[model samples]
Target: MPTLLTVDIGGTNCRFARFSIEKGALTLAGTARRQTADIPDTQALMDACAEALIAPGEADALVIGMAGPIAGQRRARLTNAPLELDLSDAETRYGVGACLLVNDFLAEACACLTPIGAGAFPVLGPRDAATGDGTIGIIGAGTGLGTASLVRDSRGAWLPLPAEGGHAAFPFTGKEEADFQAFAASALGLSYLRGDDVLTGRGLCLLHAFLTGERREAAEVAAQGLSRETETLRWYARFYGRACRDWALSTLCTGGLFITGGIARRNPLVMRCASFRESFYDSPQRSLLERLPVRRYADEASGLWGSAWLAARLIGALPA
Candidate 1:
């Protein structure tokens, strides 16, 4: 059996898992978590993540999926968090035979390639829409917006394309939107707002504040089953749809769009809301947008599983 230690680092929390593969099937040995805010130091936090999954020298491979752009494949710092990781010495210092690092959404894309992927997410649009062919686009919003795409190669092998699309500027048109943009700019102290900042859980809080003139946490807003008239959820849904629309068009996805994250997955009402459909289909190329099937990855531990799956592949335990 091939043993692996995997880590999924997001803005809010860190998930650690120990996986063993046999006969190409993944078995979860154990799992653990630590809040990102609780990380007192970089070295200590890394050690804690490693030991939580497996003892030193026990893991054949260590794989990590992080919520930021990967640098030279093994170096990255979280976009919304303060932790910076340089895993250049992991193979020796961490006692793992190898270390693999990738953008968190790239791991999310790879998860949809596995059997668990097939049984995990539910389609949100027309059942007949997704043919499960051609290129697939993945986007999700939680603490931050994450994006990636999966494409088939000449060998028919699926290859993952990672992106920093979330960091790109998000557009706001019309007077109402312009007003909110100005307010957000003032609130966030950023003249130029990125998609990651505006289409995220934090963004939902901002929307709530703008609508009600009251500040609330993201969880509070998500939990309150407020009506459509509230406008907070309506605008959030609209922004999410816009993000999805841009990614689908940029990737030119024929397979369909896979949406995942704590936002739409935990509270599916956002995807079903009329505002989402309207904004998504509002593009000048409306027909093209309508043709794209949509699905949402629902598993909360999706990134952890994705990291383990990619780890197995990187270590030659599973087919690439």
Candidate 2:
């Protein structure tokens, strides 16, 4: 059996796990989690992970799914968090045989390719039998908005395609939407607003202030269940649905659209609301959207599993 160390580094928390691979299957061996704020930088984060999860030389490989853009095969810079990682340095500092870094959503997308277990629930449309030849799309809101795709290659292996589509210009459907865009642009001192400006955890607070001239943390607003807060969540869900619909149409994702992130998982009512499905199916491609299966992934440890899967593949322990 081969052992692989996997880490999911996010803005709020960092999760680490060790997996044992045998006969192309991965079994969770040990796991630990810590607040990213407590560990200021990547070096410290990796050191803490190794201390909590495994001995320095026990793992064969290290795979990290980080909440940021991967500049090259060896380096990644997290977006919301103050951390930059060089996988090359990790190999020396952690005593791992190999290290791989990828965008966090790419790991989430990889998880969609495998059996997701029971951490997923339907949100819109009926579950359709995937033809196994089309694309699978994923969109979620956490510390930031994330997007990715899974497509089959010529060899029939599913390939993870990571994207920073979250920073794309947010779509505006009406004057109210346009007003929000202008407000966000002026507030952020940008010419235009990106999706993350209005769809993330911080974005929720911003939206609340825009709507009611009030400032509250995302969690506080969510807990209050006030009319204004409810309105904010509905707006968030609607935009999220639109984002998902756009990705689905662009990728022709006949497989399914899987929603995973801290926000959606924590607020099941908002996901199940009619506002979400209404906006998702409001497109001109109504027939296509209706046939698409949409689900909210409930598991927080999904990225860890995904990183392990990639590690197993990289080590040739799993078939492509």
Candidate 1 local lDDT, 1-320, one digit each (tens): 88888888899998888889977788888889989877645476567865676653588878889999899987899988987888787767767687888999999888777654665454445565534767988899999999999998988777899998898999887999888888888899997788887878778788788878888888887887333445777888888888888899999888878888878788787887888888888889888877787888777778878888888888888887
Error of 1 at 252 (Å): 1.0
**Over 4 Å off, model 2:** 128-131, 225-229
Poorly placed runs, candidate 1 (over 4 Å)? 40-42, 120-124, 128-131, 225-229
So what's the TM-score on candidate 2? 0.93
Look at candidate 2 and tell me the lDDT of residue 181: 80
Which has the greatest lDDT? Answer: 1
lDDT of each: 0.81, 0.80
Give the lDDT of residue 141 in candidate 1: 91
lDDT of 2 at 127: 58
